[model samples]
Target: MILVEGIGPLATIQDLGRPGWFDSGVGVAGAADCGSLRLANRLVGNPEGAAAIEVLLGGLVLRALRHHTMAVTGAPAPATVDGMPVGAASLLELEAGQTLRLGLAETGLRSYVAVRGGIDVAPVLGSRSRDTMSGIGPEPLRPGDRLPIGPVPPAIPIVDVAPVATSTDEILTVRALLGPRDDWFTDATALFDGEWAVSTDIDRIGARLDRRSGPPLERRIRDELRTEGMALGSIQVPPSGQPVVFLADHPITGGYPVIGVVVDADVDAVAQARPGRIVRFRPAG
Candidate 1:
């Protein structure tokens, strides 16, 4: 068992996510950065989709009730065990009664911690992921919460440390395919030409973007469109013209027109982006 000592801004248990629930009005709410979560799980010898703790902007502290193998990944949060510093993306051995604390993330917006055995939380919709938008799954972790660990898996971890990009100030470029409503825009190329800054209004649902200069995307068709299905990474443009890139907990459908869709691989980078980070779009080949 692991005891939650401190919960910083937000912390939640997550797995790969509950898929196939969109038709039922449920969004697949997993780790915002699924690749980082998978990497943490791999370091702990757990399945890639095993349940783990997703820490937002770090500051999560956990105490082990028993011996456990653990790993921290993503965001490069400073970690320590009983006051001794530990490295991220590497295996950590925690003895009984030992405490692990994670400081504020040096870069990126979220960090992940995985134990040898996944967090044994009750599953809702066949997943342990917490959907902040729908109030589904377990509640956000709080201080003094005791989390049970699952039985250890047979697979053994081979790598001591895994290589991962920490974070960078370089403007992030994401590829998108102009889409179903591209014709509605006065100039679809505007999305690719203009530079955008990530807005402060980011969450598990989506990250809003504001153009650095020039007018936002203008609509040629002022007519109200019927609500349509929305997918992860769907770049929806509202009447205000600013684009919002849907994330893990995005709504199943939206009324706003989708100008384009970011590719899946690049969505991970989008999730890690912090407020004020510059982002540029490029046409997907």
Candidate 2:
């Protein structure tokens, strides 16, 4: 067992996510940057889809009740065990009664911490992921919460550290595929031509962006789009014309038109983009 000593604004347990429930209005709620979560789990000898803790902007402290091996991945953050500094993406052994502290991230926005065994939380709808939008699964972690660790695997971790990107580039280039509603806009090319700035309006649901140049996309068909299933990375354009890129906790369906969908390879970069960061989209081929 591990005790949560402190927590940041948003921290929760997440796995690969609950899929195939969108028809029932359940969104796939999981880690914002799943690649990082997978890497952390790998470093701790856990299954790739094991549930782990997702720390937003860092600032988490955990006290171990028993000995355990752990790994921290995703956004680069200062980590320490009993006041001694430790490296991120590397495996570390924690003795009983030791406290682990994760500091604020210098570059990305979300971080993942995985133990030798995955977090043994009760699953909801085939997932341990907390869906902030739907209020499903466990609630956001808080101080004094005790987390149970699953049974550790017998196999040893193969690697000491995992190589992963830590910084968001000066201009985040997200590759996108033109969509089912591309014809709704007067000029879909404008999405690639103009630079967009990540707005403060970002959450698990979506990241709202403001186009730095060019006019708001004018709909060729002014009629509203019927509600349809929305996918992760769906770039929905609302009446205001700003593009909102759906993320892990996006609604199952949306009424707005989706002009493009960010490719799976580039979705992790979108999760790292901070407010005011410049974003540019390119056609995916």
Candidate 3:
């Protein structure tokens, strides 16, 4: 069992996320860096789909009740066990009564902590993922809360820790494919080749970007269409002509015009981006 001594500004338990619930208006609220979270789980001998703590912006302090193995991955937070600095993506054997601490993330915006056997949170709708958007599972975790951990054999899978550092500069290049409603815009090329600035208004639902160049507001289509299945990286442009790149917590149905969909591979970048970051989109092919 793990007890939360200090709940960071943005910390929550997440797994691979509850998919197949979009029809019910539930967004799959999983780790922003799903790939890194899966790898951390595998490294700690836990099920890849198991729930882990998705630490946002860092500064989380917690304690474990039993001896366990753990791994911290994604976003390169200054994570450590029992006050001792530990490298991200590396495995550590922790003892009972040990405290885990993390500082502000230096590179990426989000980091993941994978316990030896994963957090044993009750599954809701077949997922332990806490969907803040739809309130699917338990409410966001807080300090003084005790979280359960599963038991596992000693054959913990060990992996070589290769730290990945993505560019945190103002301009981030993201690959995308033309979207479902691409034809709605008179010149789709303007949407692709243009440089967009990540607006101050950004969150789990979507990141609003200030487009430097695109179809003039005068030429925008104001017709609202029926709801449709939304993809993870859909780049929707509202009537204002400003592009809002949808992320993990985006709704299943949106009335705005979808100018493009960022390629699946580049979705993680969009998820890790903080406000004021610049996003440059290019064609996948």
Candidate 4:
């Protein structure tokens, strides 16, 4: 078991996600930076999709109730166990009663912590992920919470340390495929010419981009769009002309037209982009 001593602004339990339920109005809510979560679990000898803690901007502290192996990944944050420094993406052993601390992220926006056996939380809708937008699954973790650790697997972790990407770039280049509704816009391809800034209004639901370069995207048609299924990284351009990139907790159905869809390979970078960071789009073949 692990005791939460102090938690950061937003900390929640997440796995790969609850898939195949979109038709029932359930969005796929999981770790915003899934690549980081997978890496952390791999370091601890757990399944890639195992439930783990997603820490936002770090500043998290926890105490181990029993000896356990753990790993931290994602954003470049300073971590320490009982006053000793530990590197991200490296396996570390925690003795019972030892306190583990994570400092604020130096670059990216999210961090992931994974224990050897994963967090043994009760699954909801076949997932342990907390959907902040839909109010589904586990509640946000808080102080005094006692998280049970699942039984460890017999297999041992082969790697001691692994290198993971951390966002430190001022401008992020994301590859996107042109649309399910590109015809709705007058100049859908023009969106690639100007740079958009990441807005402060970002969450698991979506990332709103600031149209700093020029006017909002011009629509060729003024008719209301029928509600359609949305996917992660779907770039929906609303009436305001500003583009909103759907994330893990985005609505299952949206009325706005999606001009483009960011490739799955680049979604992790979108999760790490900070507010005011410049974002440029490229056509994905």
Candidate 5:
């Protein structure tokens, strides 16, 4: 079995996510950088739905009680096992009782730690992810929280993790299809045609964009009409005309007018976005 001994900062159990629970008002709480998590799972030969650790900001320290294969992905952070400096996007063969420590993240906000058979956590609502919004499963990892790792499935495949190339481009393009309420923002064609800066107000709930020009929208949707379902990347604009792009932790229902929905492929980039980052919306059509 795998073991996590010394954990620091915000560490939480995550899997692919609690999908299909949106109808019941549950947010899909999973790895913020899901793409990286998937890769780490593939590296360790675990199924895509395997549970792992989602390290926020960064500062997680742990150890393996038994031999296991692990991988670290998402963001550039220095991780080490027993001070040997074994980290990055590669499969690691951790020996029994080896100490694993994750240092501060250098470039990104969240990182993922994937184990061979995934973390041994009971499923709630058909998933292994923790819903911080709903207080589902265990709460975020606190100091001295003894993490339980599942039994290692017999064999782990060998994987090669090449050094990841980081991007520094100012323009972050996200594919979007227009309108659940396109008519509301008729004057703001620039929402699709213009460049927007990632507002400093961005967070797990949503990422707001700095508006260049648009008339303030009236939150006209009646209370009766506010229970509409939301797709993952729906870009909703409230009375402020400031767009709050929904993230994994967003509520299932919202009162604002959704002007567009971001494309699936670019969702990971949206997940990794930091405040002050510049992003431009592109029409998928």
Candidate 6:
């Protein structure tokens, strides 16, 4: 078991996600930066889909109740065990009563902390991921909460330190395929021509982008469209013309027409982009 000593902006237990519930009106809620969480789990010799703590903007503190192997990945948040510095993407050992602390993220918006056996939180809908939009799974972690660890896996860790590319660039490129509704826009090419700034309204549901230096995405069709199913990474544009790229907790359906769908592999880049950071879209093919 481990105790949450302190928490920062946001922290929640997450695994790969609860998929296949979309038709039932459930979004696949999980770590925003899924790649980072997977890497953290792998480094600690756990399955890639093992549940871990997703820390937003860092500043999460945990106290160990038993000996455990751990790893921190994503955003390169400065981490320390009992005040001694520890590197992200490297194996860490926490003895009973030892305290682990994470500082503010250096670049990205979220971080993942994975233990060897994973967090043994009770699963809801076949997953341990917390859905902020639908209130599924566990609530956001709070200080003083005690988390149980799962039984140790038979397989041992093969690597101690792994090099990972952290989110450090202020301007990021995200690739997407145009048009399930590109024709609705006056000029869908503007999405690739303009550099959009990540807005402060970002959350697990979506990342809204502000037109930093270009015209807003003007839609030719002003008539309201019937509600349609929305997918993860759908770049939905509302009447305001600003685009919102759906994320892990995005709604199952939306009224707005989607101009594009962000590439599945590139969604992590969108998730990690900090407020005011620039994002430039590119054609997928």
Each candidate's number of clashing pairs is 0, 0, 0, 0, 1, 0
TM-score list, all predictions:
0.98, 0.97, 0.92, 0.97, 0.89, 0.98
lDDT of 5 by residue, 175-275 (tens): 89888777665444567655677787765567888855344444444343455777778898876777888877777877677888988788778877877
**Tens digit per residue, CA lDDT, model 2, 31-79:** 8998999899989998989999999999999999999899999888899
Of models 3 and 4, which has the larger TM-score?
Answer: 4
Predicted structure 4, TM vs. truth: 0.97
Comparison by TM-score, 1 against 4, better one:
1
Query: Whose lDDT is higher: candidate 1's or candidate 5's?
Result: 1
Candidate 2 or 6, higher lDDT? 6
Ranking by lDDT: 1, 6, 4, 2, 3, 5
Runs of candidate 1 with Cα error greater than 4 angstroms are none
lDDT accuracy of residue 201 in candidate 6: 96
Instruction: Give lDDT tens digits, candidate 1, residues 235-278.
Output: 99998888999999899999999999999999989999999999
lDDT of 3: 0.79
Lowest lDDT 10-residue stretch of candidate 1: 161-170
Two-way TM-score contest, 4 vs 6, winner: 6
Of 5 and 6, the candidate ahead on lDDT is: 6
lDDT of 4 by residue, 173-260 (tens): 9999999999999889877988899999898888999876754589999999999988899999988888999988889889999999
Better of 4 and 5 by TM-score: 4
- Tens digit of per-residue lDDT, candidate 3, span 1-285: 888898677788889888876667777877777887887888788888888988888888878888878888877778778778988788877788999898998766788888887888888988887776776776677998999988774555857575565564778899988868887777776765657777877776778888665444233445767867778889887777788888777788877778789887888888788776777778898
For the record, the alpha-carbon RMSD of candidate 3 to the native fold, in angstroms, is 2.0
Per-residue lDDT tens digits for candidate 6, residues 1-285, read 999989999999999899998878888888899999999998998999999999999999999999999999988799999999998899999999999999998888899999999999899999999999999999999999999999999879999999986544778999999979999999998999869999999999999999987767898999999999999999999988889999999999999999999999999988988899999999997
- Candidate 3, residue 168: lDDT: 42
Candidate 1, residue 131: how far the Cα is off, in Å? 0.2
